[model samples]
Target: AYVITSRCAGFKDGACREVCPCDCIYDAGEQFVINPDDCIDCGACVTACPVEAIFADIDLPAEHSAALHFNRAFFES
Candidate 1:
C-alpha cells in the first residue's frame, strides 16, 4: 500500500484518486488515504500525487511512518 503523508494535509488533490485503477483512494477530510486491501500496489497513485506524499509501506520514511497508521485507521473505522 502507498500511504499518503502530511504533505497532503489540506491539499487533497484529486490527481492520485483519478489515476487509481482500483479506486481505493478516498478523501479523508484532512487528506486522502489508500485502501490497503483493495490496492494492488500498482503505484499509479504515487506518480499522480502532486505533493509527492505517496509512499509504499516498506519505503515509508521513518519520520512519515505515522501515515501508515493513519491510512490503516481510515479504513478500520
Candidate 2:
C-alpha cells in the first residue's frame, strides 16, 4: 500500500489534493490519507506535498519521524 509519512503531518495546503489523478488522497482532521484501494500509485501526491510527507511504505526514512505512513495505512486497511 502507498503511505504518507511525517514529513507532511496536519498539512492542509492541498497541493496534493489538486494533483492526485485518482483522487485517492483524503483530508483528515489531523492529516491527509491515501486510500490504497483507490490509489493508482501515481506519485502525484508525493510531489504535491510541500512538506515531503508522502512516501512508499518501504521508502520510509530510517528515523520514522512522521505519521504519514501510519495515517494512510490506518484508513487503507
Flag regions of model 2 displaced more than 4 Å.
Answer: 65-69, 72-77
- Look at candidate 1 and give me any clashing residue pairs: none
lDDT of each: 0.90, 0.71
Roughly what TM-score does model 2 have, to 2 decimal places?
0.73
Ten residues in a row with the worst lDDT in model 2? 64-73
User: Per-residue CA lDDT of candidate 1, range 7-56, in tens?
Assistant: 89988888999998889999998988888889999998889887899999
- Name the weakest run of 10 consecutive residues (lDDT summed) in model 1: 1-10
**Which candidate achieves the best lDDT against the true structure?**
1
lDDT of 2 at 59: 80
Question: Which candidate gets the maximum TM-score versus the true structure?
Answer: 1
- 3-68 in candidate 2: lDDT tens per residue? 765555666678887998887778765667777677787788787788887777668677763554
Cα TM-score per model = 0.95, 0.73
